[model samples]
Target: MSLENELKSLIIAELKLVDIKAEDINDDQPLFGEGLGLDSLDAVELVVLLQRHYKIETKDLEQSKEVFASVRSLANYIRAQQDRK
Candidate 1:
């Protein structure tokens, strides 16, 4: 699967978002607030998901904010990290 799709799936599964489907998420749609109805706890789960699944460390608060913006942003961040390796 594409990275965005994969990230969507991870978000749904990890967050236990029972009503959401991977295909239902838009790449540019915000993961929090009005877009997915996610809250701060969801953000924490996403951080763990990224670290566990992709080994993407997001310990920096400001950087984590940008990385968790959307599926596309997370995918780009993962890709960029992979490139650096």
Candidate 2:
């Protein structure tokens, strides 16, 4: 599966997001606020999800904002991090 799809699945599963599926998410959809209804706690969970699954560490607050923007962005960040290795 594609990384975006994978991330969507992980996000739903890891975050325990009920009534949602990978196909239900849009690539460009916002992950927080009105889009996916995620809050700050979910953001922390996302950080742990990325680290546990992708071995990624998002320490910068500003960078985390961009990285956690959407599934597509998260996938891109993971790819970029992997490419660096």
Candidate 3:
């Protein structure tokens, strides 16, 4: 499976977002107010998930918003950070 698919699966499984599926998450969807409707706590969970799954660390609040934009964005960021390491 693709990284985005894996990411979507992880996010759903880890975050327990019952209603949304991988395909429901658009590549450029906003994960906050107007899109997936995730809150700040969910964002924290995303950060923890990324660190645990991808072994990349990030703590910047604003940067987290961009990185957690969507599954595709998170996957791409993980791939890029992994490559840099």
> Whose lDDT is greatest here?
2
Top candidate, metric TM-score: 2
In model 2, the runs with Cα more than 4 Å from the true position are: none
Better of 1 and 3 by lDDT: 1
| TM-scores, each model vs. reference | 0.94, 0.97, 0.88
lDDT for each residue of candidate 1 in 1-85, tens digit (9 for 90 to 100):
8989888888888889987799999999998889888999898888888889988888899998898899999999999999998
Candidate 3 structure quality by residue, lDDT tens digits, 22-54:
888877777788888889888888889988887
Q: Which pairs clash inside model 2?
A: none
Summarize candidate 2's per-residue lDDT along 9-83 as a digit string, tens digits: 889988899998899999999999999999999999999998999899999999999999999899999999999
The clash count of every prediction, one per candidate, is: 0, 0, 0
Score residue 2 of candidate 2 by CA lDDT: 94
Model 1, residue pairs in steric clash: none
Worst 10 residues of 1 by lDDT: 11-20
